[model samples]
Target: MSRLTVNKTYKLYIGGKFPRTESGRYYELKGKKGNLLANVSHGSRKDFRNAVVAARKSFRGWWEANAYLRGQILYRIAEILEGRAEQFEDELRAQGSTPAAARKEVLKAIDLFVHYAGWSDKFQALFSSVNPVASPHFNFSVPEPTGVVAAVAPERSGLLGLSSVIAPIIVGGNSGVVLASQSRPLCSVTLAEVINSSDLPGGVVNILTGMRDELLPHLSSHMDVNALLLCSDDPAEQKLVQGEAVENVKRVRLHPDAPLDESPYHILDFQEIKTTWHPVGV
Candidate 1:
């Protein structure tokens, strides 16, 4: 008798737990050579809805957490990701990256976390300002997190791209529900595992795997999601999301066309500017 290889079917990461899709549907994942790789959960509208609820529930705590503490949590995630570098490299290789590229991507992903960790407490100061006023009132303007952003991770790069987008979201004190790359879903679930072990609060970041077209409508139309971050070139799809977002007065940011890069502006992309006026005494 011949021994059989057990194929593992990965599930969606929601509210800090891995659960099979409520619809119990899955798509066949193929490797670079066109062989069957694994079964990735085909997440449904219900799953996206549940993720938003979880994100909303955890918002205030993450929002109010001191910046230093948030930076530490992000650093901890980098630690875990660094320890599992070889595993991420393997996943990247299977998903069509060359050995050298795989190694570089793994390193980049780790560095991305650390880079954003350093910025966690600093961006606010660089971006916030006090304005001179002619009146007796002093004016101050600051950027603050927009709660519950739902994003479609870029389709081209897997772990590197996913990390590029996610690090800034949580570091800025915003909770997120992100849909992973449809073509390369393996590393995302693995990242969820790393996040789970890194002392991040449950629901602070949610990752789901599914068809982008299938999930975009729900992510856009949901009333509870405060912002939408999308990476798509299709004009029709972009129009659809923009139209739907108007119903809830949601912020819609179409991700830039360039490859994933680290910048403090990316973090500010998810933030809203708040202005305050205070009376001054002579």
Candidate 2:
């Protein structure tokens, strides 16, 4: 008698829970050599909207959480990822990465988390400024999270590119609804599992596996989403996002070529500067 192989089902992660797409749609994930790798949920506009709702619902709590606590959670995510390094390497290899490249990407993704963790509580202070004025007044500006964010993760270098775009957004307290790479989505789903055990609040970072071409416009035009992060090299996609973003004027950030970066600016890119003034008695 032969044993039956049970396949693992990859679903969308919303509110820290895994659920199949509401539309009951699915797509086949094929490897570089035309082997069936896995089945990923083909997320729909309704699915993205549901994730956005979850994100908005969880935003206040996550935004008001202790900065140090947020940093701790991010570091914890990295710790969990490190423990699952082999798993990620295997996923990367399944997604067409060479052994050495998979190892490097997994390592880089882990370090990227820690890098943003260190900046979590510090970027605000660095971006803040005390304004100079001749009048009897105290004036200053500080950075604040931009509420719910939506992103189209890079189409290539799935693990590392996904990490590079998301760590910066969430480290600063913004909740995100990100669309993972269409072809190389295995690592993205696996990372969602890592996040679930890393002390992160539900809905803080939702991951959806689907076609970026179909989701980019919805991510842009959605009024609830306060910002958009894009990592594709497609000029048409970029133009579509920018055009749709005018509906609510979401802060849009695009990285056409290899969106990998350790800079704090990426964190600030999703933030807004709030200035205040107070009268100082002479």
Candidate 3:
């Protein structure tokens, strides 16, 4: 008798656990050759709303965590990812990346995490400034986490693009809810597993897999989400996000068809500047 293979059912990573979509709807994920790969939960607006609530609940803890500790936690995520390197590479290959491309993306994702980990403790100093005041007071500005961020992960490169968008946002202590690539979402789910095993707290980063059109409107318009990071090429979608963001005056960062790069500016995108004044003679 031959043993039958059992396929895995992918679910949404919300709060801390993996739960099937509330709608109980799933979409078939097929490989490049049109073979069934897996059944991915087709996340709904309700799911995105749930994710935002989770992110909001956890924001203060993650935001107040010591900068060095945040860096350590991010580094731990990189360690966990490094251990699962082979698994990620395999998933990327299954998603249609050539073997070399898969390996490259996996390595790049790991390195990107480490890069942000290194920046976690350093960004504040680099971005902060002291202002000369005439009122006999010391005035200075510092960057603070913008609470909750909703990001649309790049649709092209599964692992690398997702990592690029996420690592920087959380490195500065902002918790995030990300919409994974609809066509290639395996790495995002796997990354959620890696995050779960790592020291990063639950709700610090929530991963949802589904259609962008289905999720974007809800994510962009949600009042609880403090910022939006979009990685897309669609002008219509970009316009829609900008228009909806007006409801909350949300900070919107649009990367229209742009390749991901290593920069501290990405971290700044989700940060709010706060200035403090101290009486000099008090």
Tens digits of lDDT, candidate 2, 175-247: 9998998988998889999999999999999999998778877899999999999887888888999999998
Prediction RMSDs, each to the true structure: 1.7, 1.3, 1.1
Error of 1 at 244 (Å): 1.0
Sum up the clashes in candidate 3: 0
Q: Residues 95-173, candidate 1, lDDT per residue (tens digit)?
A: 9999999999999899999999999999999999999999999899999999999988888888988898799889999
- Runs in model 2 deviating more than 4 A are 1-3
Ranking by TM-score: 3, 2, 1
Model 1 bad stretches (over 4 Å) = 1-7, 257-259
Each prediction's whole-model lDDT (CA): 0.91, 0.91, 0.91
Model 3 residue 39 CA deviation in Å: 0.5
Angstrom error of the Cα, residue 154, model 2: value is 0.3
lDDT of 3 at 103: 90
Worst 10 residues of 3 by lDDT: 254-263
Q: Per-residue lDDT for 1-282 in model 3, tens only?
A: 899987777899999889888988999999988998889999999999899889999999999999999999889989999999999999999999999989988888888889999999999999999999889899999999998999999998788888898899899999999999998999989999999988788899999999889889998999999999999999999999999999999999999544479899999998999999998884
**Global CA lDDT of candidate 2, please?**
0.91
